[model samples]
Target: MSFLGLIGCDNGRNIRSICKNNPEICADLHKDSWCLAEKTKIIQNRYAVKDSEVTTGKQLYIQLTDLEDYSRCIELASGVQHIIHTERTADRARAFRLSTENLSVLQEQTRERQDPFMSYYQWTRFGDTDALNRFLELENTGEVSDPFLLAQAATYYSNRNAIKAQQLYLKVFAEIPFDDFDVNWLLGLASTYRQTQQFDKTYMLTKANLLLTQQKYSEQKMLALLGGNKLLAAELDLKAQTLIDSLEDASYPLSLVKIWLESQAVAADIKPETLPVHSDEK
Candidate 1:
C-alpha cells in the first residue's frame, strides 16, 4: 500500500493529490500533520522512518499556514530529547504573526525545561564564568539529556566571553543542522567571528546568510543583510543596487524604490544622513 493510504480517507486524498503534484510539498504537508498527531503511528507506519521523524514533522508544521495545527505541532515538538532544529524552526516561523500562539507555546516549553539544561543560579548568570562552569559540568556529568546546553553556552559566549562563545557556537554549529536555529544566531556568530578576527569563518557564515536571503527575500532578508556582517552587507548592497538600477528604467514606484535603496545603503554601512533628498518638484 502507498504511504498516503495510511493518512486515512479524509487526509489521504489531500496528501495523495499534493504528493502527485509535488512530492516535496506532499511530504512536507504529511510531516506537518503527523507532527501534530498524538502518536507517530501515521508516520512510523508510512515507510522507513528516521530518528528525525519529529524533526521532519516540525519542519512541515513551520511551513504550514494553519494556526491550530501549527500550535499543536509546536506543543508536540517541544521538550523532546532532540529538538535544536525544531526550536529554530519554531523561532523563525513564530516571527510571523500567524504563528504567534505557537511561538508562545514553544517559549513556555523552554521556560518549563529551564532547570533541565541549567541550574537556577546558572540561568541567572547566563553570560558569566559560572555559566561556563555549569556547561562543562553538564558535559562531564555523562547525562546527554539536553542538546540546547550548547545553544545556551553559545549565547553566553557571544554576549561576554568571546573566546568561549566562539568555541561553543562552533560546537553547536557542527552538531545542529543549519535549518535548526534563528537567523540571529547565525548573524551573531558571524559577527563574533569577525570581531575575533576570524575572517574566514565570518565570510563563510555571511555567504551562507546571503544564500538564505536569496532563497527567501523577505523583511528578514533585509534585516539580516543590514545587521553589520560586513561580508553579507557588501554583497546584498550590490544586489540591491542592481535591483534599484533595474527598477529605475522601469515603471516601478519611486517611493518603494527609495525604500529599497535606503535599506541597501544601510546594509552597506553608508550613512543615511548623507543620502540625497528626493525632490518631488519634478
Candidate 2:
C-alpha cells in the first residue's frame, strides 16, 4: 500500500516536513489528498460532536456516549501511521488527533516479550534507590534510554530539591521544547528562587513570565518596582490606568484602578498618587 493511500498525507507543513524527512516510511504518494481530506472530515465530525455535547447536552450518559465516540475517532487516527506520514506531506489541516493506542499496544507487546530474569531483577531492585542509581548509571553509559528516571528527577526538584529540579527541568526542556515547560517547570524555578530569597532571579522570572503570556498589566509591576525598575512600574501603571478607563462600566473601571493602586501600595510601598496616572484619570 502507498503510504499516502494507507493514511492520507495532506495535513500541514509539520506533517509534510516529517514525510520529507522520512521518505522510506512515506514512499507512496498516490491518492494522498483524498485520504487526508477523509481523515480531516472524520476528525472534524468527532470534535463537533464533542463540542456540542460539552455545551448543550443534558443527559449525562449521552454526553459520555459522545466522548467515547470522540475517543474512538482519536484511536483510529493514531493507529494509522501511514496516514500520519501522508498528512505530513501537505499543508491541509492544523488539528488532528495523535493517538496513544499504538504506544499502548507496543508497550503491552514488549512486556509480553521481556525476559523473566531481567524483570525479576528490576522487581527486586525497585525500592532500592542506590541500586536503581547504579542501574541508571549503567544505562547512561550503555545504549538504553531512561525517561522514567528523568521524570523522577523532575519530580524531585519540583518537590523543593531546587538544584536537582533545575538541572533536570533544563535537560527536559532542551529535549522536549514544549509549552508545558514554561507553565509548570519554569514556574517551579521561580518559586525556588523566591524560597531562597534570590529576589533578583525571582523578579526576572516573574517578569519574563508576564511578558511571555502577554500579560501587560499584572502584579509584575509591583515586583518590578520592588526590584528597582521604577520607570517600568510607572509605565505599566499608566497602561493599567488607560485600560481601566477604557472599560464601559464606570463602577468596575474605578474599582479596578483603586484595587490596583491599593495592591501597589501594599506590595511595593508605592502610594496611589505617586503612580503615573493617565491624562484621562480625573
Candidate 3:
C-alpha cells in the first residue's frame, strides 16, 4: 500500500537525507540506533521499488523479505534497556511493532497471488499447499524463470528426489549468468550427483564451486576424491573452468557445459526421474 510510498516522492538524496526529509518514511523507524544494517537494506529496497514504476513481483517479494528482516532484527534490538536513553529502547520497540504489522499487511495483500515469487513467499511463510502448487504449475508452464526461485525448488527436491534436484540445478545454470547466481547451486548439484553415485560429476561440480568461490580445500582429500588419478582430476578441473567461462560469457541455453553434463548422465545410463512421489505431490 502507500506505506511503501515513503520513497515514492523523493528524487535524489543520500539515505539519511531521504529519511530526514521524508518524515512519513522514517517516523515509525528507529533513529539510527539499532538494526542499522537491516534498516539500511529496507530503505534501499523501498527506494528501488519507488524508482521502478513497473514494479515486478520479484521487487515486491524482496521488499516483503527486507521488511521481515528488519522486523525480526528490531524485535531483538527492542529488548535492551538504556537508563540514560530510555527513549532509544522505546523507539526500537515502536519500530518493531510497526514493522511487524507492515510485514503482516504486506503478506496478507499478496496471499493467494499467482506470481511464482509471491507464491514462494506464501509457501515458505505459511506452508500453504495451494501456493506451492501454483508455483510449480507456473514453473511447468515456463513462467517461473528467476534463478533464485529455481535454485530453491531444486534444493527442495534435493533430499527427496535426487534426479529431479539435479535437473533443476542444471536448468538454473543453463538459464542464468554465472555471476548472477550463488555458488551454492553448484554445491547442490554436487550433492545430487553424489546421491546418485555419479562420482565424477560430483567431484567436478564441487570443484567448480570451490574454484569460483576461491575456497581452499585439502590436497590430500581432493586427491583421494579422485582416487589419486591426477590426470582425470586435471581433466575435470578443466571442464569445470570451461563451464565457468561459458557461464561468465553468457554462453548458455545450449552451452557446451550443459551438453557435457548431460552426456555424462547418458553415458552412465542415468535416466531422468520426476520428484519422488510424496505428500508434496498432493
The candidate that achieves the highest lDDT relative to the unseen native structure: 3
Clash counts for all predictions: 1, 7, 0
RMSD, every candidate, angstroms? 15.8, 17.4, 7.5
Please give, for residues 119-218, the per-residue lDDT of candidate 3 as tens digits.
8988998999998888888877888888889888889889889888887888888787666788778788877876777766776787888788777565
TM-score for model 3? 0.76
**Regions of candidate 2 where Cα sits further than 4 Å from its true position:** 1-103, 111-152, 170-183, 220-282
C-alpha lDDT (0 to 100) for residue 219 of candidate 1: 36
Candidate 2 lDDT over residue span 1-282, tens digit each: 343442354455434544455543233222244345433433333333433434321122222333334345444444455555765433222212222342233334333222222222333324544444544454445422333345444555565665555555444433442322334444555455445444334444444454445544445334443465666555554544443233323343245433432221223342221221112332
What is the TM-score of each predicted model, taking all chains together?
0.34, 0.36, 0.76
Instruction: Return the number of clashes found in candidate 3.
Output: 0
TM-score: which candidate is best?
3
Candidate 1 lDDT, tens digit per residue, 1-282? 444564545544544453565453324222433353422332233232332434332232222224444446655454343355575455434433334554455434443232324342334423545545654566546442343556665676685766666656555544554345445555566666555554434444554554444443333333333343555556655554443343335432344433332221212342211111112222
Each prediction's Cα lDDT score?
Answer: 0.43, 0.40, 0.75
Candidate 2 Cα deviation (angstroms), residue 98: 13
Candidate ranking under lDDT, highest first, comes to 3, 1, 2
